[model samples]
Target: MSISGLNTLKKGQHYTAKELDSFISTTDAVLLSNNENQLFTDPEREYKVTHELDGFFEHSEEDAEKHFREKKAYVVEKA
Candidate 1:
């Protein structure tokens, strides 16, 4: 989510945590996301990288992709 994108969530409708999470699933950035449980980020793509693979750490985009191809790590991004 972008700075202004946060407003999309706050524009007049009060949302519950579960309802907000549904909205957060479609957002484009992490920091502006409504999901507080999302604390991990890939250093390479910043907002585009939502979750880290279990038991895996990434320091670079290339490394992340490599692991992804090998099914060692996976990421979550909205379509």
Candidate 2:
């Protein structure tokens, strides 16, 4: 899948172990280090995080379209 654009997830999303590791690679050490020094430490946290990430990864395109459409409508109304 593609990995860039406003539709692409940047942070704050659920992620699989592999996906989380990939994210960790691109993240700052301080942020990760403060989070118990690991990305997938707790199973419960992992589950929740992964679920959120999955939703974003799967629906980001649709979400972006909807977001832009709403923004455009708002701008039109304001003008």
Candidate 3:
């Protein structure tokens, strides 16, 4: 029930709304499991924006149809 890995859910954890809000807003974007093992990063450190994309494609059927109707091309450059 965790969204963006900030424990933004309290389905059974009994977390207060304010507590969840604080964690979601202030805590770093990192994953923490029940085993207390930190994955993908050091919990105390901030991560850098390693990459970015200019645009993305419409994945939904309706959205893709609309995109094609509008004559928008979903282009992907070859690496």
Winner on TM-score between 1 and 2 is: 2
RMSD of each: 13.4, 15.5, 14.6
For each candidate in the order shown, give its overall lDDT on alpha carbons.
Answer: 0.35, 0.30, 0.32
Q: Is candidate 1 or candidate 3 better by TM-score?
A: 1
Candidate maximizing TM-score: 2
- The positional error of residue 55 in candidate 2, measured at the CA in angstroms, is 26
TM-score of each: 0.26, 0.26, 0.23
Tens-digit lDDT string for candidate 1 (1-79): 3332342343333333333344356553222333334533322222233443333432566454423122222233421
Give me the overall lDDT of model 2: 0.30
Clash numbers, per candidate: 1, 6, 0
lDDT per residue as tens, model 2, 1-79: 2222222233434434444445445643212222444445542343122111221112356455432111101000000
Would you list the clashing residue pairs of candidate 2? 13-53, 14-49, 14-50, 14-52, 14-53, 15-50
Deviating ranges (above 4 Å) for candidate 3? 1-44, 63-79
Quote the positional error of residue 48 for candidate 3 in Å.
1.2
Error of 1 at 39 (Å): 11
Best by lDDT: 1
For model 2, what is the alpha-carbon lDDT of residue 67?
Answer: 25
Candidate rank order under lDDT? 1, 3, 2
